[model samples]
Target: MSASTPFVKMNGAGNDFVVVNALERAFTPDAGQVRALADRQTGEGFDQLIAIEPSTTADAFMRVWNADGGAVETCGNALRCVGWMLLQASGSDKVVIDTLGGPTTARRAGPDRITVDMGPPRLDWREIPLAEEMDTRGIELQVGPIDAPVIYTPGAVSMGNPHVVFFTDRLDDAFVTGSGSLIEHHPLFPEGVNVGFAHVLAPDRIRLRVWERGAGLTKACGTGACAALVAASRRGLTGRRAVMVVDGGELDIDWDEASGHVFMTGPVEVERTGTLSL
Candidate 1:
């Protein structure tokens, strides 16, 4: 490995990332390397590491690694951040990005803002890939006493990534961290899951926090917010479109009734540009 790699630090709704241009230099860091870069105390520090590589179909291919060095299938906030970068570089309003999940298109919504067509939310049991067959709208899962559970019958959805959302009136940090950690590795989800605690504030608004599968807690989680909206809507707790307020900021999520695709709109910030001594 060379020690002359360059990278850009960027964020979308405060979900920070370290982005590298693998298309130019062809650098692919392994799990250990990714962990070193993602460590907040000893490394460059980011919620995720993004590699922008060449793609045969789309404008570019995006590879994502969580802070724990686990590669994930998709990341909505990263997609928006990458879209903004590619748009700035190519001087185009739209770009198609290829991911392990599938292809998605992004367009400029405003100055420094992006709108990504995240596609449909997978609501089927086989799609979320639970360990057993069950209804995704409210799966057979609960925490606390059997008779009166603290969180029960939560919903599951996959926006190219699996997520389990629990609707509640409280947004306790301890509950989110502890319960999220448990459900993230629970047996019901064979592939593990991103656990989200959503507090519905109104029919068109929700407050959310997420413990990412391999990233732990984060300032913002784009797909988590999207999943929150879908789960809330399916349960009639909220409308199909709503504003998701995360710890870092807010995002507008809309699950189109006609198309079944979800659209996420948010802002991206460029923190700094620097080179990494790999």
Candidate 2:
């Protein structure tokens, strides 16, 4: 018999994950293994796979893999889930998490809620890493036709990963899943992009739907919510703070004016626990 590893199934809002404690037992799954594990019918179904590893500079290091078996720089919802785990283990109010993006800090906001300081939003075209130098506030991209495009002039921002937010008057599922998938593979974005469809209800509230780079459409995206707030604020569509209403639940997002750091607060839920044969 092969060895098996203990796993925890967790979700932040509706963004689900299969978490492995690499700190307890060192294990890294290859792309094939990741794909097999991500299979909804055959294995543990999840939007992402998170590995909690030991870190010297922070409480723990979070490694992320999208459902498509691709490694990513960061994931806001996953961060919150990992933060909750670390806080519970250490019995601390706050903890720092290290990732490929950088070091991030998370604090206890309330019961079953965590607030993560996602550092600063990368607004430069180079940082967002577009194919060419263009204004990130409103990139020249459109869907449909050139005369009257379906969605155009999207604001680009990087919350450790590439994203583009298109402000629209209405939020539609067909549009999000269809057009979003097209934009995610646009040539302008060299490394692909997470596409956000945002409808600003008020200066302090926004309704958002995200088509993640490798995860398809998810219930909620933590970094997607943060990027929408920042992009909207930059475009004067909303204030620096807003409540992002997603498919699963709501997230409170605040972009500090002074420090320019974005904070995301949301709830985390533990779904189940099991072991995966390796």
* Candidate 2 residue-wise lDDT, 1-278, digit = tens: 23788899999989999999998677788888888899899989999999999999999999999999999999999999999999999998899999998999999999989999999999999999799999999999999888999889999999999999999965777889898899998999999999999999999999999999999999999999999999999999898999999999999999999999999999999999999985
With candidate 1 superimposed using the best TM-score fit, by how many Å does residue 170's alpha carbon deviate from the native?
2.7
lDDT, candidates in the order shown: 0.93, 0.94
* Candidate 2 Cα outliers beyond 4 Å, as residue runs: none
List RMSD in Å for every model shown. 0.9, 1.2
lDDT of 1 by residue, 173-244 (tens): 788888989899999999999998999999999989999999988989999999999999999999899999
Please give the clash total of every predicted structure, in order: 0, 0
Can you give the TM-score per candidate against the true fold? 0.98, 0.98
Error of 1 at 30 (Å): 1.3
Worst 10 residues of 2 by lDDT: 1-10
> Which candidate has the top score in lDDT?
2
